[model samples]
Target: MAKKLELGDPAPQFDLREDGGGTLSLASFAGKKLVLYFYPKDDTSGCTMEAIDFNRLLPQFTRAKTAIVGVSPDSCASHEKFKAKHELGLTLLSDETKKMLEAYGVWIEKSMYGRKYMGVERSTFLIGPDGRIARAWRKVKVPGHAEEALAAAKSL
Candidate 1:
């Protein structure tokens, strides 16, 4: 596993297929802060709630000059359905190969019910306009996460 990224580290760059079409890249977010969140799957309870929370607070994030993008191993088609079902406003990117996930150090070994497996650890990164990580939250709790992220973005 790659070392966990720390504050001030350059955020990993990514170019991925986004839901509803088109590509999203780290360069596209230049001159603006980014909230890059990783979730294990689409449409799962925690993932859905996290997306909803980010969607709900999207306007605030926009006002803060921050853009939010959610990443998951789900396909672009799956992302589309999930976004539509939840009426999500933020971008959802597919990382089917998990390259970006590994680059960001969020794809990790996880244990549930005494069983170990590889999965995306629910994580969030705040990347400043200068492209350095401002903050990171690993093993994120869904509730109130968006708000906390927004607060950090606003401080940037």
Candidate 2:
């Protein structure tokens, strides 16, 4: 398992296929702050709400100079459908290989009704323009999360 990241740790690097037929990488946001959120799957209840909340707060995040991006272990096609279905205005990245997920330490053992499995633990990382993590929220609750992240970004 990768070591848990802490404040000031360099954010993990990633280069993945985005939903809308393009690649997105950590380097693409160079000299800009980034809000990197990880969700378990696309089109699920909690995931959908999280996406919508982030989308609704996109303009606020942009005003803070933070670009919001969602990542999941779903395919690009799945992300595309989810985005269209929800009218989400955020960039969704496909981490089908689970490399980026693991690197960020969001992929882990989960228990649901006595069934143990590996999945993403909803999390968010606020990366500063200098490529270091400014703040992180692990096992995030959907409600007010986007707003909280934005507040942190703005204060930074």
Candidate 3:
């Protein structure tokens, strides 16, 4: 069962393969604010826009002392291709096993045109330096979402 996350709850831990042949873990981001965004797939319209938006604002996010990391079920190779194709300047993590996806509760059943299937729900979590969730957004709409997240991160 997926738990409904609340503010101040400890962010779910994860250690996953990154696009650049390195491992990134929740513990690795200790004491740093993290903007962790999860999307359904790579190379999709909405997902691409979201990734670009986040990437474009990399400098601002960096200035705020916050790191942004994107996560999806796509393999490390796929993530690398997506990054190269889009010229995205953000770290992308692969969760091929869906362990991190399940822990974050973004992997869920969805109905589309009367068909039900399991997939990622497009979510974002703002993890505080203390390792607790400061904010959580589920079923995210892409437009202006990255800017909103940046604002929140700046305030923290």
Give the per-residue lDDT digits (tens) of candidate 2, residues 52-98.
Answer: 99999898898889999999999999999998998888999999999
Off by over 4 Å in 1: none
Query: For model 1, what is the error of residue 130's alpha carbon versus the real structure, in angstroms, after optimal superposition?
Result: 0.3
Pick out the ten consecutive residues of candidate 2 with the lowest summed lDDT: 57-66
Best by lDDT: 3
Higher-lDDT candidate of 1 and 3: 3
Model 2, stretches more than 4 Å misplaced? none
**How well does candidate 2 match the true structure, expressed as C-alpha RMSD?**
0.6
Q: Report the CA-based lDDT of candidate 2 relative to the real structure.
A: 0.95
Structure candidate 1, residue pairs in collision: none
Q: Compared with the true structure, what per-residue lDDT tens digits does model 1 show for residues 1-156?
A: 678899999988899999988998999999889999999999999999999999999999999999999999999999989988888888999999999999999999889999999999999999999999999999999998999999999999
Q: What's the C-alpha lDDT at position 94 in model 2?
A: 95
After superposition, candidate 3 runs with Cα above 4 Å error: none
The worst-scoring run of ten residues by lDDT in candidate 3 lies at 1-10
Candidates 1 and 3, the one with greater TM-score: 3
Q: How many residue pairs clash in each candidate?
A: 0, 0, 0
